[model samples]
Target: MATTEEIEDLIARSALGDRAAFSRLYDRTSAKLFGIILRVLKDRASAEDALQDAFMKVWRHASRYSANGASPMTWMITIARNTAIDHLRRRKETVDADDAADRLVSSTPTPEQSAVAAGEARRITACLDELEQDRGAAVRGAYLEGRSYADLAESFGVPLNTMRTWLRRSLQRLQECMAR
Candidate 1:
């Protein structure tokens, strides 16, 4: 790994469109960056994907990095972590009733175990059921899938403003429910 001063100097040159400097920076940081992504994603393929995306970001955003603030490695690690989280969120979008059923069926439970899970699920269901159906759906779609409101609006076939309203209202309702 390059020393901190060396990495910062490379970042400065990279910002000036020096490809060789950027390549050296990549060589110095890829292992640490991969490690950070792997910790968040817990899947080798996903971690590799995140690492690639993060380096692309580094190449583009090298000008924004500063030695006085975070070290280049830390900045790179943050990029990797965010990218992995984004991948996980996007991967979750396919989850819905059918998928949930499949997940439940794949894991059989003893009677006592089933009862405990049922009780917790019942409470959660009751709280969610209190919200209007659309509001509930909006909250679940955003929270569980980590999809943006814009994406949900497109999926819901509603206007973007309407989707925003649904999300805002849904959050308020959930807050009120949880408060009690």
Candidate 2:
């Protein structure tokens, strides 16, 4: 672990385009910076990305560090912290498709939901059974099968208005049965 003065010397050397000093500085400080970024981002992959971005900023702005009057490690840590926060903000703005896919809830009904649905189906079936046989069939055809009134009338050998009447009356009866 380098002392604060030693880290500052490395930053000054790096400012002068000394690759060895920059590499040494990276070695001394990357772990602490990475730790900070990981704490902020909470995801290892995103932390690594923030770490990279933080270092890129460090390399670019190393020349300006002398006038900042902060210790070199503090400077680097500030950069890493701000970069991690920005990374988190950007991540919040755009969701990854893979993440979205992973988060997708199953469309299949839960057991309780399925049970309630089955009970409703049974009730509707019972109500239909209470109707006259032809009327029950007509109700099923018009509602369940999605047949038009004219088509149901043709199939049942009734006038269009008569089929409409049967459906309206049958629904009223079903609604009453359901209420009970």
Candidate 3:
């Protein structure tokens, strides 16, 4: 249990990019932060994930910590709690997105729905065909085969970051084409 002055000193050192001080701060406070996250998240895995996020934020924003008579532990607790809430919200959004995706990709369709789907598929194909080089095939492989960016990068003989940029730009172009 570090004293408040010691914790403040550790944070100050961490702000100065002292890895040792940051490590000490983490050792001293991670348990309490993890407990706060767990209380909000209500699941071990999510709480653990939020704990890591909170610490990463603390590390990145150590210079932003204001010591205006506020306790260091309270600041960390606030960060952990907010991170857990954000994780919970993202989890909820993912569930909703999954539901929306299921509706979009349903196997069964009415005649009208089939007509709309056919038109959309034709538009998508047209947009994909408009893509120069093998971009279209890469997009299909990514979405249809559930392949990862790393896999695509290796298959296409490009760096991982390059593949990611290619995919991003390709998707943007596709979106622009589809909107027309």
**Candidate 3 lDDT (Cα, whole model)?**
0.73
User: Whole-model Cα lDDT per candidate?
Assistant: 0.69, 0.75, 0.73
- Superposition error at 173 for model 1 (Å): 30
- Show how many residue pairs clash in every candidate, following the order shown: 0, 0, 0
lDDT head-to-head 1 vs 3, winner: 3
Clash pairs, candidate 1, are none
| Residue 159, candidate 2: alpha-carbon lDDT | 96
Model 3 spans > 4 angstroms off: 67-69, 94-180
Question: Over 4 Å off in model 1, which ranges?
Answer: 94-180
Inter-residue clash pairs, candidate 3 = none
Return the top candidate by lDDT: 2
| Tens-place lDDT digits, model 2, residues 70-130 | 4567678778876776676566665332321112233456667656655665699888899
What is the per-residue lDDT of model 3 for residues 57-104, given as tens digits with 9 covering 90 to 100? Answer: 777777767532235775666667667766766775552222111121
Q: TM-score for model 3?
A: 0.50
Decoy 2 TM-score against native: 0.51
